[model samples]
Target: MAPAHRDLADIIITDELAKRASEPPDYLREKLAFRDLADDMADNPKAVLPRLVRLAMEACGAESAGISLLEHEVREFRWFGLHGALAAFEGTRTPLDYSPCGVTLQQNAPVLMKHPETVYGWIRSAGISIPEVLLVPLHLRRPAEDGGAGTLWVVGSEPGFFSLEHVRVLTELAAFSSVAIRMIQAEEVVQAALQEQEQLTREMSHRIKNLLAITDGMLRLTARTATTKEELVAKMSGRFLALANANQLVRRPFAHDTISRVGLQQLMETILKPYERVSTKGLDVALGDHAINSMALVFHELATNAAKYGALSRDEGQVSVGWSIHDDRLEVTWNESGGPRVCQPETRGFGSTLIETTVRRHNGTIRYSWLDDGLTAAIILPLSSLAR
Candidate 1:
């Protein structure tokens, strides 16, 4: 019976039906039709694609039309901008491994399949009858093989429905769709980059403010307690070194530079190391490897202020830290005793700001009391956030 098909490299005439039903496409109408797509592409790129699907259907005089883009991450060809008989199946996800759209992209040309449902189980399962489908590849990404190719296709109303002219019109539309989609993707990338920059700005402002405050407080405390210029310089150097160590310990997550994990107990001990001694109670909590760097800053500021002017500055002064978990909340208490008569500062310093901000970031709260003998501070934080 010979081969029941007559085919070319990019064109396939499966049967005599395609020849019997030929009507050369109108070039003038094709030219006029692209105007709307161009206007939409310029005015609103997002709006152009659905119009493209509708235009492809209208221009080709097909029963249904849609666009399928290859998502390399999931290795799937997701259907978008559907129209006509199969419009209800919008947002359908088909595996890239076994799809005609994938084949069109792989072939890097237009593909005309006769009765595709006979071969593709998904099409048969979808329960829509397609006599023929004319697909044109959209090279959304260059080289196509690196996985950024897609397809714009129209389902024919009857067999042998597409001709060379139909292929030409669809091909032009597919090219235009490729440009519009690339523009849309570029705009999305810009938006995402802008959002990340905004977040980074906020974080930087907070860090700068806190760092200045910590340095200011340390200078004042070191100057007040230093017996001589040499002693003051030595004390300030030691304190600054300790602060750097604390910051470096928790810096990885912020810089996105490297990964490191420090336990809750370890962070507290390191930050409080500059002070003579800080007795830690209930410091054993398994919050896993996701450590909060902000907590390290809080403890450093607290212990720094203590060394400069609080209970830790005095010979007989003492500081004890204890924590308790109640339901979903963790409460930490800081008690100072055996020091000089204590009075709260008239102005709030950066240390206080750092403490309040860190607590608030975790949806937590902190309070301080100036007792006749010493300073007492209480912090309450969400255990869920801490554990995470």
Candidate 2:
């Protein structure tokens, strides 16, 4: 019951073939090659490409090598790397058809000129120099959708330097490296576009908010006129123009976090300029460029009322408006003296509503007191809302 010798031999051959098939693909070999190339290229790209030029020459067993890349902006060929006597070609640019690499790229294939001297029949007509050439297309996938077909790699020197094995390896590596370059370029483009879109969105939001505020201010100012119905209509037309002016100031070519503090002061003064003729000699008004927009509007309306009926209406009356910051808020005091005896109004009007709304929007509080001689208004506004 012994087994035949042929059966044992067949069993051994089958086991060996199965073991070979079970072994992994040579991914480790490919990874090691890529790591070595990347390490060599880490320090300086100019040196890396040039040294790659020399290594390619050694791999082909050639006397020299020249490497060129396509520069589509110039529609020309440029020598990016060189080895040995051909090193002078580095940094040189020439028309596409006048360079050997140009033909490889245009044809989308490899070119091997076996005879150095006799290839001139084709070379001479194209205005190219031929002394033995091995040109390979560095075929890259498009960097962006609009990119041209790949790049060209020209390696030329003495004759018969490129073996079939050398051509195969170089072509494969060039294809992979070109795609990596295109990927890097695509990521940069996407990042830039995102940054620009974010900036535009912020600016648009700012402009829309400013326009709404201006329109609301104008409507309130118009409803307060009490001269005659005919005069009231004329006053509204003027208020509309002032609103338009303020809108133009806020929307301009550059970015700013808030209206300029100095500009806010001037705008407030201009808004109340018509009331300066009030006859009170002792009436004093003091404000500065440091006040914010919400506070500015509140103080402007209070001044207008004083000129019409409070301390500023008579020569012997006196009034003062001043502000100072304390703790987390700003405290403003409006005091009057020597005016007619104070009394509370039975109904609130447009002026009262404007002042209340502007201060409340900033989360501020206001109190008005009627004393025997005059009216006093005190305001406290949080600094956090007004600082910027």
**Candidate 1 Cα RMSD after full superposition onto the native fold (Å):** 8.4
Candidate 1 ranges beyond 4 A from true positions: 1-22, 144-148, 244-388
Instruction: Judge candidate 2 at residue 48 and give its lDDT.
Output: 50
In candidate 2, stretches whose alpha carbon ends up further than 4 angstroms from where it belongs are 1-210, 213-231, 234-293, 315-318
> Residue-wise lDDT of candidate 1 within 1-388, one digit each (tens)?
1222333332244333345555766878777778867877888899999999998898888999999988888888889999999899999998877777877877787788776565567877887677778888888757534554679999988766788777788889988998999899999788877766676677567756766776786688656666899988876675566557655654434334233445667767777765775798875654422234567667766777777788888888899989988887888898988777778788776457657876787788999998876889999988777754
Q: Give the Å shift of residue 332 in candidate 2.
A: 1.2
Q: Which ten residues in a row have the lowest lDDT in candidate 1?
A: 1-10
> Residue 379 CA error for candidate 2 (Å)?
1.1
Which numbered prediction scores highest in TM-score against the true structure? 1
lDDT of 1: 0.75
Best by lDDT: 1
Superposition error at 169 for model 2 (Å): 30
lDDT, model 2: 0.55
lDDT of 2 by residue, 1-388 (tens): 2121222122111122222222233456556766766775554333455555555666555666655666778877666666666566567666666444555565566655533223223334444343345666664454344233334343445333345555555565566446544554566576666765676567658656864765566566655645577765664454444444444434323243333333433544455455553222221223222233444456556765675678767777777655666786767677877777768888876667777877887788899998877789998877666644
